[model samples]
Target: MTMRAWVIKQYGKPEDLVLDRIPVPSLREGGAEPVDTLVKIEAVGLNFADEIAIAGRYQDRIEPPFVPGNEFAGTVVQTSGSSRFQIGDRVACQVRSGAFAEYCAVPSHRLMAIGDLPAPIAAALPVSYTTAHVALFQKANLTAGQTILIHAAAGGLGIAATQLARSAGARIIATAGSEDKRRIARENGAEHVIDYRQPDWHDEVKALAPQGVDIILDPVGGQTSERSLRLLGWRGQLLVCGFASGEIPALKANYMLVKSASVHGVYWSFDRNPEEIATIQQDLVGRCADGKISPLIQQVRPISELIEAIKDLGTRNTVGKVVLAW
Candidate 1:
């Protein structure tokens, strides 16, 4: 059967995306044959990385005629060689590509069941929320009553980290670019929000947490990580999530020795240890199920507007997770 997809005809702008008919990707088990299990994508999540991909500036990643999405939520349409996902089971998955299409394939192992949450929320969780979960709880060893400073606190991972930190009983001090973003952070449980676009954003962060935060979750990188070290409490930790700011920062050794603070590099892509991810996923699922931690989705649009949505992400104009539905 034919499927509609947002094909990246060339890497440039939203206007460059070409919607076209494409073959539905086949499901494969053991790499042998097309299996019956089919994933009908219901929603796709957009991130700043998709924007970078569109402009041919996505870090070490190369250009695209490639589909730009990474995460999606879908329902099973068929099944073979996989009993775990029954027909019609609702699942969310992370993939290198293919989610922009009407249909995609998901190995039973990659599927995460989301009982009642909408596809938009499910699509938003796998990558961005997982990064936040990995950084705060797994990498930084977040514990109750700790104080944390989250850069880009209204962006995808930022909002996730804010919610996750608060759920873990960590006092949240967040940094955003504007008043609207600051309001979003506050609504998502950030105790303090600073306008990081200002030269004294870190100063404001320090003022709020005078003793300094125990952990700083920095994805902006470069100068962000460099300057954030100054606000670390005694024996605090800096969790390096990504270099979304386009600059990777190097640190002075003396800075580490002075505060006895440690820098942790958290690569969610590398945290592919399934057992560990399963455990954390379960933790997240339980909390989410109980409504203790919510999937705070802020924007939803159709896949037809996917390109425009991605461009909006590049402008950093979005708050919380931005998702596109079928």
Candidate 2:
């Protein structure tokens, strides 16, 4: 059967993607893989990484004439022989790419039931929340009662990190690019919010944490990386999540040695056993179901406006997750 999808003929800008009709994929002959699940997508999540993928700058490069999306929520129309889920189940999942379509074939291991939550919200969960959990609990070793400085606290990644850290009983100092964003950060459990545009923003953070913050979650990598180092107490850890600034920053080995601190690079897309990913998805799904975590969707655009939605993300005009809904 023919299906509608946004196809990327080349990699340059969001407008470069074109809507086209394509054939629906069938399960493999004989039998489908035990891990495969076919879903009719209802919503797709947009990320900064999507823009990077389209620009051919992502760590994992993609060839042109491809689909560009990583997270999606949908209803399972065909089961790939996995008894864990049946046809007509509502699910959400994260994949390497190819989610910008009417349907997607995801591994059953990555699929999680969304319960009664809207599909768009479910679509926003996997990538952002999983990345936050891994970065805070696994990489940075965040502990209760610690101080955490979450940069870009109003963006998708920042919001996830803020909520998770707050739930862990950490003191949250959130930094945003504007007052509106700062307000959103404060509403999401941030104890303090500062506009990073000011010249003395670091001083404000220092004033709050006093000695220094125990953990720093930094997705904005340019000068923010350099400033975050100064706010780290002895033996503090700086989690480098991404370079959303377009200018990648570097840390000096000598400086780290002087402060007795460490800089950790967080790459959430690391290869792992399907079971491991499923476990994380399960935790995230439970939290969403309990309303412990609510994704702050900045905008929900129609599928036909996919290009415009991507452009808004590229310009940083959005405060939270931007979703393209069917």
114-184 in candidate 2: lDDT tens per residue?
87878999999988888898899989888889999999999999999999998899999999988899999
> What local lDDT score does residue 161 receive in model 1, on the 0 to 100 scale?
92
Model 1, 1-326: lDDT tens digits are: 88888778677876787888878777666653234457899999887667666677765465567666788988988777754779888888776667788988766666688777778877887888788898887788899888999999888899889988887888888888889889989999998888888898887877788887899999889899999988898899999887878788988768789889899988765225866765666566566768776766766887878767877876776777888898
- Model 1: weakest 10-residue lDDT segment is 28-37
C-alpha lDDT of residue 102 in model 1: 90
**How does residue 299 of candidate 2 score in lDDT?**
73
| Residue 49, model 1, lDDT | 69
lDDT of 1 at 39: 88
TM-score of each: 0.91, 0.96
Clashes of 2: 0
